[model samples]
Structure formats: C-alpha cells, structure tokens
Target: MDIQQQLINAGQYLKANQLAWGTSGNLSARLDDHHALITASGTYMANLKEDDFVTFNLQTGTYEGTRKASKETPFHTGIYRVRQDAKAILHSSPFYTTLFACSSETIISELFIETMYYLEDIAYVDYYHPGTQELGDAIAEKANEANIIMMKNHGVVVFDDSISEALMRIETLEMACRMILKAKECGIKLNLIPQEVVTSFLEDSKYKPRKKKGENFQR
Candidate 1:
C-alpha cells in the first residue's frame, strides 16, 4: 500500500484498539528527505480522508494540501530532521500509557521478550504546551535516545523505520504500562529479567538475526 493509505489504515487501527480517539492524535510518514505527509489539523484519526493530510516541507516548514497540517508538525519534522532512519511517527494518548505519563512511575521494560525489545529505551520529556516549538525541541533532544518518548502530562511519540514498526512499538508500550499498573494494584511484585539475560537475548537469541542493525535496541 501507499504511504497515505498506510497512515489512513494505521489511524483506523489505532482508534479501534483505543490507542487514539476523537482528534487527539497525529500521524506522519516521510515522503522524502525534505518533505513529510502528515495528518491535517483537527482531523479525527478514525475518520481520515486523503485530503485530511498535508505535504509538509521539512526544511522550509511550509505545507500544501486542502487543509492545514497538524499543529504538532514542529516535533514531527524535528524528529525526521535528526533521525535519518525514522520514516514514520505516531503521537497519541492511549489510556494506560497516558495514565503512566501523568505519574512519576518508571516503566520497566525487563518484564518480557516483547517489552525488552520494544520498551527498553523509553525517554521522558517534561510537559510543554502542545504544538509549541519548546515542546518540539524537548522531544527532539531525546529522539535519538529512544523510539518511544513519553511526554509528561500529554502523551507519547513513537517513531521507527516504518509505520507498522512504529505502531507495534506504541502498542507494546501501552501493554507494558498496563501490566505495571495492574501489578501495582494487585500488590504483586513483578520479577524483572536479569540485565545479563536481557543483553544475551539481544545479542545471541534467534530474534537478533531479524532485527535491523541499530534498530529498536538503541539506548
């Protein structure tokens, strides 16, 4: 499928999975080194049309389409500017992830195989009013350190080499967050996988062959 259709399908998937609702999230894909295809401002993720997207110039910070680009375009472009490997981004406030974002709790990625691979390098960005350059800058500073960035009192920004990978990351993060919260509520002490074991899994496991070099396991 085309990039536009991939994003449209992603939006519907996000909504159906409760990862996004109303017009609360934004999605984007790199069209080239200089431009991006991003959701238009105020468009519902679940009900997007082709025209609901704008072609944005990364260098000039201008856009063209039937509607204006998302107000959060700054950070979307900022991330693409810094991370050459990043081809897609998804920013949303899923219930459990947002609940964790609002708290001081730390996310433990050593809980399982998927968690170790996907949630291992989360970065937390302090709250900044949405759509501001300050907010964009804050997130960009940590973009290289992690694929999943938890924005305090706001939401998360996840990016990867493809839209599908980015979606998988956010879904994994939300699940990890839910597990942590549920464990705490039940007064259960979760067993963390040992650091040595985690390292071995990343290096020697069969799954290692499937991972792109320097992808997903970044510190």
Candidate 2:
C-alpha cells in the first residue's frame, strides 16, 4: 500500500468523523518494522498534506525530515514494539467513547455481534499526562491483550493489523457507548447477549481474531 496516502486518508476519515476535534488526536502507520509515519504535533487531522507527517525510527527514537513528530509518538512506537500484528495506530478523543472512558464503566456489555467480534477486549488505563513516558508505558502494558483501550479521562487508542480494522473497532465502541446512554435515558433495561453465546463466539476459531481474555463491566 502507498503508506503516505493511507495515513492521509486515515487522518481525513478521523476528521470527517469528528473523532479528532480541535487538533486533539493523532494517527500513525508502520513504514517498516523499524520506523513509522506519524502526524506532526498539533496538526489538524482533517486538513493534512504530505509534508505534515514525519518518519521516525521506532528503535532509536529519532526522526527524519523537518516536521516534528506527534507528542504521542512514544506510545505509538511502544505498541508497535509489542504487537507484531499492529500495522496502524489511531489515537482519538471521540465524544461518546470518552464519556465511557471517564465514567465508572470498565466495559461495555456484549450487546451486538460486531462489538463482540471487533471489540472483544476493551482495556482501561488510568489517566496519565498525555505525551509523557508515563502514559506510554501504561498504554503499552494494557494493550498486550486489548485491541481497543480506554484512556481514563482522556480518549481511546486502537491498534490493529489494518487501519480499517482499527477504525471499525473505534466506530463499534462509539456506537455501543451511544446505545448504552440511550437505553439509560429511556429507562429501559438492557438485554445483553447471554454469556454462553458470547463464550461460544469467543471460542469459535472463525471469530478468534476478536477474543481476548478479559472481564465484562457495565456502565
């Protein structure tokens, strides 16, 4: 794939979807096992140009080109270090997803097949100052078993084998959060899928890509 165009397209999608507002998010893609193409710090995700990204050595922590890398570069590299399956990483602060992230909710219940399949394990990390080594360490540790991570009082971070898979997981979690809020507003009790059904889905090899060992918690 043309990685530069791919990163540009991902940025545009995040902007168009309002996943990153007020220059609050960042995106990156693996250029090779050793380096990544990342958005520059404070650049608007919606309006990006080829020069807006920088190539950074994930191993040495040095960057090439005149543009500076995003402050969250450490976390991006950290995730790539551990996850051989991760080809792309997106960090965005979406409205509904952040709501659950800041709340007491540790997990969104299994209410849909897509949520169960694409976002099977959602990990929550305690709030740390963004762009700091502390936060990067926390994210790297939690991401060991999570494709989607809820940053406490912050946003969500997702890394997947492909950008589409990562973005889809983000969308799935956002929709699930919206559904939970709507149900509460209506005073309607939720009808979650049974544990047996969820377990069956998890154990099935066909859907094994989504399943990760974790617990379920309601908002």
Candidate 3:
C-alpha cells in the first residue's frame, strides 16, 4: 500500500491501541520534498480512513482537504523544522503521561530497553497554547535533542524518520510511564537497568549494521 493508506491504517491502529482518546492526537508524514499527509482536526481517530488524511504543504502548513487541520499542526511543523531526519511525527495525550504532566514528572526510562533505544530521557516542555507559535517553539527547541517530548499538561510528542518508528516510540514511552505508575501504586521502587548493561547494550548495538559492511561490500 501507498504511504497515504499506511498512514490511515496507523491512525486506526492508534485508536485500537488506546494511544489516543476522542479528538486528541495528530499524525503526519513527509509526503515528498515539500508536503505531508496528516490527519484532519476533530476527526475521530477510531473512524479514520485514507480519505480522512489531508495533503499539506510543509512550507506553508496548508492542508488541501481541510477539516481545519489539526489544532496541533504547529507542533508537527516545528518537528520537521528542527529535524531534517524526522519524516513523521506522532503526538498523543496518553493517560499516564497526562498524569505525569499533571504532577510535573520528568520521564526517565527506568525499566524498559525499548524506551532506552528511542529516549534516553523524555524531556518535558513547558506549557504553551495549542497550535500556537509558542507551542511550536517550545517543542522545536527540544525535539532535536530528544526523540520523545511530553508537553506540560498536554501530551506526548514523538518525532522520527518514519510513522512506524514514531508509533513504536510512543508505545515504548507509554509502557515506561505505565510501569512508573504501577510501581508507585504497589509501593515498590522501579528497578532501573544497571548503567553498565545499558552502556554495553548501546555499544554493541551501534556496530551491528557496520559489522556486515566488511564482508558484504568487499570494496
């Protein structure tokens, strides 16, 4: 399937996975050198389809099949503006993350290896009005430095080079958030991975792709 169709499927999957509730999340992908296909404003994610996706000019943030576009369009625009590597962005207000936002908790990847891959730490950006330049600037300032950013009293924004990657980051962040909550609930300390393990894992991982190069290319 084409990217538009894949994007639409991801929209459905977002709702199916309970990552978004009601009218609260936005998604977009780089359509080309200059445009993206994004979800429209106020559309129920549960009922989304490819037709619900709108083509937008990245330079102008103009949506062709407008349903007013997402209220958080600037946030997505901000991501692309800052990170040339970011091809898609997934922004969602999740339950645990919202709770963390309420308590002003900074996200730390304590228990999960998945989150460690995407977010060494998920930074919290100060509150800004949705869809405004303030919101854009706040996220833009930190997005390049962190893959996952949780907005103050708002939601979580994950930036990546593909829709799949963004979605996976969101899921991993949510899992970390939930685990944090569960630990609080049970009155047990979160078991953080040892630094040595984390360092070893990352070091070994970095060389995997290149390890095949010596034999495969034979230059």
Q: Which candidate is the best by lDDT?
A: 1
* Candidate 3 lDDT tens digits, 4-76: 7777777788888888888788888887777777888877777777667777787887778646678788878
Give me the overall lDDT of model 3. Answer: 0.75
Cα lDDT for residue 69, candidate 3: 73
**How good is model 1 by TM-score?**
0.95
Candidate 1 lDDT, tens digit per residue, 68-175?
899999999889888888899999999999999999999998999888888768889999999999999998888878888999999999999999999999999999
Candidate 2: misplaced stretches above 4 Å? 205-219
Best by TM-score: 1
Displacement of residue 20 (Cα, Å) in model 2 is 2.0
Clashes (backbone N, CA, C under 3 Å), per candidate, total: 0, 0, 0
| Shift in Å, residue 171, candidate 2 | 0.6
Q: Give the lDDT of residue 172 in candidate 2.
A: 85
